[model samples]
Target: MVYITEELVRRRAEHNECEIFSLEEVSLHQQDIEKIEHIDRWCRDLRILYLQNNLIPRIENLGRLKKLEYLNLALNNIEVIENLEGCESLQKLDLTVNFVGCLSSVESLQHNIHLRELFLVGNPCTEFEGYREYVVTSLPHLKCLDGTEITRSERIRAFQGLVEVKRRVWEQEKEYLRRRAKEKEEAHRKTTGEQERKGSKPGFDGRWYTDINNTVYVQCPGLEENKENQEAAENTKLKMTVPDLEEEQRREEEFWHTPCPFTPESRLEAHRHLEEKRKAKEKEEMKPKTPRTLITAEGRVMNVNEPKLEFSLTEDEENNAIVLDLAVYRHLDTSLIDVDVQPTYVRVQIKGKIFQIVLPAEVQPDSSSAQRSQTTGHLVLTMPRVEGEIKVTKGASRPARVCETGRSSSSEGQNRKGHVPERLEVDPSLHTAPDYANIVPRQRAKEGPLERARTPPAASSSSLSDGFEDDLDVPPLI
Candidate 1:
């Protein structure tokens, strides 16, 4: 084993141009050194020392280095951490790969208040239950452990885990003590019976009789020695089994008074009841639900009986097209409106009004186009008509508007001041139109009457116009 001599220390100090008195660091690692010597007396001002990777059995002879801030004794045979009480300035300690087997070994460094980083990886203590927690809780000032920064959550968990480990250990110890006491009691009973049989005397009638007063004297030739031995054994058995018996009785009472008892059938029944409840809930969820009606943001249900918006559907046989006119009175952002036109249904939702119209006949929805009039505020949807009869299927229940002349009733006309006799042209193709439902009128407009009479009356549908004049006063269509 190579030893660190004073001559070698002097030579190293000269080579590094460091004087012995002011030397701040020393590295004697991997020198096959078994013991640390002369360093405390020669280099008293040393601040950092590396004695790792050696066969050092224990940490010792470093108390004189009061200014030491860093110490690395890793990869050594350090079974316990002791003799570190004078390392007041130590900020980092590396004892990794060492044989620190117990928390008490780590507890020896609790006085190191300035220790900020510690490395105990590859140590035997790592195998202990709650070792990390024990170390962290024991050394509250440690900032980093085993190359990882200690966090608050880890600290809290460590404390709780340590408590649980200690509780389990205590319970195990109690059980072991109880078992030992029981074994000792059994052994003591056997010994006492053997002694009594050996101490028995034969009476004149040829029967063996144990005289309690002279039992010790009869068992052994030395009466006092045998009595003392018997008394000591009895005292030991009492000391061992008394507490165990009391603890057993207390535990039994606690169990007997417990409010709930654990049984497999009860647990199975509870699980089955929960499963049945879950299945019932699933079945209830699987039931069909009715479509929800639209409601305003202010909690008022949208009026389906009396719609706020009125629109007209006109079929042009000459052009083979269908025109839908929707009156838009409220100032609305066109970007907010969404319209979906299918072959069988047309859905329009703008602001608060939602309308879905089942078509009287199938139309080409892909070829449909919609345009908004800037001046009149009318949204017009034009769809190419297909050659087919109206299917007459049930549609969403909604207030309907119909005119005898088969013309659209204009909101502008109803609010007009002067009575203008206007004649509306009716399409002959629309005479066979089915009842149209599920239409919501737009908000009332503040505009004058539109020129509905501008278009010339068609000759094919004149009778429908005459019928409208004959029955001019018709109630609102339901």
Candidate 2:
């Protein structure tokens, strides 16, 4: 089948009932794609679109197609399953032979009531032996899966098998009921005859029955029943059963059978270490602590409760780059006042939900030593900046800022600021982030906030789609 162009798609749109299109076997590389910005635009009325063996990379192109019902994206380099946010009509999706490895990426597709079939055959995600079963259990509507179809014959066979099983169960239940009723009748007749012979009320044979049927009996000496007392009547019998003792012993043995993986020497060492640690922890709890909170990389509370802000700058020998390491204090509070940044004077601003750390040009370096001299060569480096600080929220619940400033650059191309005027000055052996890495060009001040308020606001439904522009500059812990 031929891949549609803008002209071809325009011609097809005029034709009514043209609901399906196939663009198979086309070597549609990223560079070859000139005008298909979002392929869904051309196939807005499409019910099925076969884009098999095409060189599609991302799923952002399919996010706008609200009418998509069936899609075949097999043999693509797709790694993520996204952009199908509101395609409610999508019933079947063929993602076989793709690079996808995670099924949780499309777990939200379970919300689609018509999503009955999903083909993920050649993908490693579906190849996991337990994954298919897990998906089936989680998504109840997933009937036909993994390039397989549920036909009418197959459904009928399953129904018939279930009916046969149910019939056998009912027969067994009926037979059990009949046997129990027959035994009850025989026992009633024997007891009535014995009572007539004695001409008195029913007497126990010095035995107690645990179950109502009296199939199993136990003998307990000094056990007497008082007809007049209701509580004694209920309490006269022993509550022990055969299964109870066995289950109790099984639990006890299981509790004690848990093995500890430690040698005798290791055990002694562990005991000593544990005792020392316990004393240290108690002393830490009793000591006067700092007023700082530590925020982890994932924005959670620090396990240890003592407060201490530690900072370090490490140099990487391989990449010739420096890394900023800041520790967050364990104490989290709402009244957290200042974040201490050593060897630098930076103004910290907390405006609403956003926190900004401004680094002046005086304290920061212009460029690393390697980039000022050579065009294409290797170089080694020493370390600098032994401390830094990162602003964290009260409970370390969120990272207010991130600082990934120190990095090395290898640029063989010209700089962006016009021509190289005069000096051939370049440092080929220094390590630093790209020259423009931390630089944000100063912008002119606009009108007051009240004056700009008259304009329409940005759509709340729209997300910040650009990845690099996301607030990733702040470090959560110091």
Candidate 3:
């Protein structure tokens, strides 16, 4: 029980500058001191303290010395680094040849961010692999570790090595948790089985038992005799009910044949009546035809006119896109055309006519573009295809479009009074041409006469009546 005392402090301070005993540094090495008590009361201004080679098992109670900058506890029995949180100005710490076994023992020093040098040689943690690297990496501001200055390359290697070490430690922790959970589940099952056994009623065979007073008792001795009596009574009851059961069965047959309410025929007739009524109601619902309408995002109703809009989807392998060609008989203001493209569908609205095409394959919406050809008056939309299959939703219900006459000029050679002219099938080969001619005006001038001849005729021309057809086969576009 060696304790630090006031007499000892005064005696130790005898060699100081003054007899008044105000010293900045104190050396109490090899003093056989096992406990440090009340040292701060006399040496409150201590800047350095050396208690090396003592029996102090823990570092504590030095927090009041706010200006403590250097502390050496080397060659002591200290096992943990703690209670120095108030030493805010501490910059150097030496704990060499101690019992510290893990890096966590020094973690309390992390709060002292200004610490620059650390010495922990001959400690149990020094035997670990990458011990110097671990300490240097953990305290990045530390310039010297174990009296050796840290290098740039060592810091880099420490950072890289810590990644693998942390991953391995994390995997080990996860497996430990899994094993603990399995152990808990097994323990719970055993507990439940024990409880079930305790709650169940005990079974009884023909057996004897002895009471506390040593009196003997027999259980279920007449079980076989009781079973024989029960069987004999059941046979007597069956003999008396035979004639009555046959009479009752005959009456039930007679009731089934009787017609009015309880007979099977009447139930069959009622079921047939309900089925006929259902069929008649379904037939009545199918008598009237209703026009299908679609509502736009702007809350406007548009009538679905069959055969009014015609479009085709052609795969342009040269352009790596799927081209959609729509015939527009009415002149459209190019600026008012609204096109919305999604992965699964494309919606195009020009004036009053709206066309929504659901694509069979997914497409990159950001790469899709719509252009109206000035030469043929056709709207061509190019969408670059993606990898996966696209899911298309059914079209929404649209409001009815109000009938307006002469709001816009019709295309040339189109009938003005009668039903709208049917759309003529255009040559699919026209889509395979290079898009530069339509997208860029400078490229159109470079087209030779042979290329110009291959261009499709304008929408106003009667090209379908020429009776000239190409041998190229075009698949139907949905």
Candidate 4:
């Protein structure tokens, strides 16, 4: 039921910069499209068209692709080789793994003199006796048949016996047609019997139900008198079925029909139909399945693979930051994604779909950063652990690295000059509060005038965790 809408065409043609008029190529494979439409009008300058692995029942609406050079219609429901006579520039045509039984349909390509290659492998017509000879004789210009080069000798032999080949091909075509007629009749009867069992009677419910919503009749002459009686109508005494169920029955009948495949992509097409029915049945059952909650009632973030994108999470002990590498689609735009970092977890919303995961350990949200790879489009998150945060001097009077006990900050954060700092472990029992106000100096006459007379703002105990050093000119408060 999926149609080739303007929005769909534009989205698929994003590589063409969303320009369909002058588009040269397009891939609309595996879209489950029941019919081919619009492309012939939308992309007139197209040279290559790939419509493979779909439910397309026929090859039409493509006669206008006069500039087309190669057309791929493999793995579809196409049963014939007609309607391609207008492709004046066609050089290659692929119709592999289809149900084309009428081998003589290959005669249509006689008009496409530019065609150099034609693929009819895995088709019912390929099984016919002297199928190669018939095609070779019909189209003397063909260079290859079913991937094999059509040698000059084969063409000469086919032309010499062209009279007998035509006679034999015609007899086989008639036999195939007779078998097809029986199949059509059987499919029609099976469908009719199923419909009879599904038919229902409309019972009294509303005046709208009895009249089938023909409100215009209510305004007509004699109908005005019946309106009063219709208002008091009841369904209690009638054999009334829910209107929704009746409507569903009508839809089901229209959904499952067999017209005898002119393009009998037999086994593969049946699989597609079964898959569609299973999905439809699941929707009708209305099963109540709750989505996985990213966060629990106890305020604990949970690990989840809801979107199931390929990803890898690892901890960098040397830098004390958890690095996450997510393999998002390289073509997906960064604008469609939103990232959120927390102490317990990281959440990413990619085009409205949420991908969340819990951290192995607590992290500092304020210090965390996220960036996307230019080449791979993989999202990389660097979350510095809270324990990895280090306190620095409250004043910029004397330049220095972090305290001997703390780790050095990155060059961008605070012009780091020293080597990578080693972790220092301290026993909690021996640790005590330090005199932050006296940590600097009470007198500094020997060191000349201070960088600023702006008395290093009184350091408060609460300033212990404030480590942001974006501005070097403004001294930090401890």
Candidate 5:
């Protein structure tokens, strides 16, 4: 059976940019999941869960979800409602289109006083006589049932009819239970018989195994969200022939149309079919992918967006550089990314996927720098252009540092107008010492040379010698 695994939960959580421990919402719908497990322990903080359209027969291993507010178990094989009394915050529950026949089992939900909405449409119990009156009176806190609002008058009427309706409901519930017991036995028998004949359960050649209209959509490998049509075309090309293709399709249709019992083996059969398809898909994906033609035979570089990531490339006039800002996934780790800076083009490889783009102008690969943003995760590349002309605006040079002496407020405001004072912009990553000697404002080329700092007047004849002649350093005093 396809049980919920930690790897699946963790992968879904990673895709959502959160860890399992802190995950508040999760969607495990239409995964062909036959059982629910691991999620209660892994996602204790989960508030919303979607487990719709699966083969899950029982609801268990979910009592620890105290924070759970909504649970959707529609289109499953769930026959009874139990073991949900611990969902203290549950406000809504969806069991629509399930096989829930035991109407009395919903009494287990009477403990869930916080439940405001309950959906049981298309279940066997919903067809039972006086189903609505029985359920409305049972779950007094329920405001909506099967998408219909439960008015105050409806509640009072249901309470008035509860006496007679409860007896009829109990009788119908017993009959459904007896019939389900027989189905269980018959399904179990068929499961074992098929297992014995096959030696082991074998997967059928189909994309999905539908039982009682519960469809599980299986995904193929190397096929992204937008590549479904391409994969389908590939599959058609591989499978379609003339005479045998039609015969095979006819047989497949006949097999599915033939009524079959929904049992453990049948549900597991779907899982195994998907498992085999996954293996075949992996084998197909392992074939070497033809890299996009970025460089032609004539040594001409071409631009390509192979990975289909959004990016912007612009000419930075002020810096005389080519700036490329690539919108990468924010949660992507740097270790999984590799960048290659070239004079003609830049290439970035993310987890074996390639994204290469040609530059508009020639650049200096040695002078190029690439950095990722901490918040936005945009990869900004600054590549100094090799052929770009550096245009300098002709203006009077201002003093790098103004050591103002006896200056008035008016003079200070006027002299410093449209001027920016220099500050020590230290970068922690670039381990270099500050150039203290260069801090003094030097005279500009058009300006006259300023007076240099003079030597100290108090320099004595003894210390004036400094380290020039130190009498052999006085026997090298330690």
Candidate 6:
């Protein structure tokens, strides 16, 4: 049982130059065997493809190969041939012993003018009464059938039968065309007679003659005067009952107040309103905020609000999220603290000094302090609180007030002054600051005082590293 899939055969044919390709009896089973899809792309010179005794059900996939000359799809499970319309150069198609019930598939082979031999012996089409007559009439170029030499008597009988059928059909079609042409001619004659009768009468061509005495008629000129008289009578009658005509005229004038669509101030105002609403909605959706903290060297702590900035960042599936390299500087040391820091994506505080920093999806704050060292350099931390020893540079210049990376100039101005500006102008009550200790690096508690509590009087002289968690210091306020 050679269970060769289409993909496997295609991959093998891609590199090989075998002229005769055969997957027959190879246990291939598919309802839709696209010929070119299974064949190798490099098999441009393939001449004969034998896919018989397999499970191909449709023939549409074979139309792509322009050079195909011979195809055998016999004795498997084909139902119809709706897909073989483009095989223009096919010469020999073996479809014998299939379950095809209709002559439609055989008729579609008419476009395959090069087809010389077709096998349809065991199909339902072959057992159909007048089957030979139908095939001979539809496909006039077929020379061989059913793996045998068609006897002279059988050929003569089939040709004679088809000739009589064609003759009868031709007579019916000729009668139909003759009747249709006769009806069309009668209709055209009737139309011409009606036009001639109307043209024989006078006063219908915009010219009126006044017959004062029937013998001496004069052409009544001045058609404009008649129109004016009719209009004057209509106006007088309407004005006698309708006093609201003046109001109708006023409304019509108001309806047509503006002649040019582009020049109207109302149109411009509506357009401006739409543009403003669009910009506001986009700003609301795209504001970036984070909640990471920075530490200052002077020991004077300043909570920095990382303002939401705008930048085009694209994400990758393999990398999971977009990487942003934030440039941090230490004003005290004049050293740049550039790091790939994943922004903190959490609710932000509305305090004037602190802003929000919205990070990309799949990016989260470093939950463990031990894991912070492995973070990539593309990170911008929104510091909730800044404390001593570590000078956190927000902006580029001296005295680095905590600033977010990639913020605009207008937003930078807002962060410069102590009070934070409402760049996004989100509802103040909806924001919440993240836990600062979870994201920010804090100084570990000293062990000198706690060590005294852990050691007994005898063991105080011995060195002990266990029970370190309980030995950590406690704040005076706690």
Choose the strongest candidate by TM-score: 4
* CA lDDT scores, all candidates in order: 0.69, 0.48, 0.67, 0.78, 0.80, 0.50
User: Candidate 3: where is the Cα deviation over 4 Å?
Assistant: 17-21, 166-478
Which portions of model 2 miss their true places by more than 4 Å? Answer: 1-5, 8-36, 149-478
- Estimate the TM-score of every prediction: 0.35, 0.27, 0.34, 0.52, 0.48, 0.29
- Tens-digit per-residue lDDT, 1-478, candidate 1: 4688976676767655857878888787876576778888888889989898876777888887789999999877676788888988999999988755544667778888999999989875566566667778889999999999999998888887777766654454455446545655664564456446557666899645656533232233344367657765444432222225577568557634655422222233344345656886899899986655655578543434123578888887677777878886647778866777777667777774676665655789889999988887778888887667564579896543457756445754576668886556578976975546514333345322222233233346644655454332333222
Model 1: CA > 4 A from native:
166-478
Error of 5 at 310 (Å): 26
**Which of the two, 1 or 3, has more TM-score?**
1
lDDT of 4 by residue, 1-478 (tens): 6898888888889998999998999988888787889999999999998989887778899999999999999988777889999999999999998878888899999999999999999888887888999999888889988899999888999899989888888888889878877876766565456434445223575211124221221223343357665433432123434336678678657656634454353444466557857886888688776777888899878776666799999999789889999988899999998999988889998887789988888899999988999999999999988884664548655553565457543333445346545445467897889879877675565442364434454456666467743454676454
Choose the strongest candidate by lDDT.
5
- For each candidate in turn, give its C-alpha RMSD to the true structure in angstroms: 30.3, 35.7, 35.5, 19.0, 20.6, 27.1
User: How does candidate 5 score on lDDT?
Assistant: 0.80
Sorted by lDDT (best first), the order is: 5, 4, 1, 3, 6, 2
RMSD of 5: 20.6
Model 6 lDDT per residue over 400-437, tens place: 24434555656477568776564544567868898777
Candidate 3 residue-wise lDDT at 111:
81
What is the clash count for each candidate, in the order shown?
Answer: 5, 21, 7, 0, 0, 24
Q: Write model 3 residue lDDT over 1-478, tens digit each, in one string.
A: 3588777676677767433236677778877677776867678887888899876778887987777899999877676688988888899999988766545556678788889899998776676556676676677878888888999998888898887654554454455446545655664564456335434322386222222222233334344358766655544432122225577568557645655422122333344345656886799798986534555679554434343677788887676688989886546667767787877777776674567766767789999888888876788889998855453669986643322343323332244657666444456666675677556443555765544555533344463456655532433222
Model 3 clashing residue pairs (backbone) = 294-398, 294-399, 295-397, 295-398, 295-399, 301-399, 302-399
Ranked candidates (TM-score, high to low): 4, 5, 1, 3, 6, 2
Q: Report the lDDT tens digits of candidate 2 across residue range 63-88.
A: 66677788777766565577676777
lDDT of 5 by residue, 1-478 (tens): 5678877787778756757889999998988897888888999999999999888889999999999999999888788899999999999999988878889998899999999999998888888989999999889889999999999999998888788999999988888778777877876676667455434444485223324222234445454445647767445433322326577478558656778655434555556656766986899899998767878899987777766799999999878899999998899999998999998899998877788888888899999998999999989999998964555679995654433354454456567857766334445787888799977666655433332122212346765655655342233322
Q: Which segments of candidate 4 are over 4 A away from where they belong?
A: 195-272, 281-478
lDDT of 5 at 368: 92
Cα distance off (Å), candidate 1, residue 51: 0.5
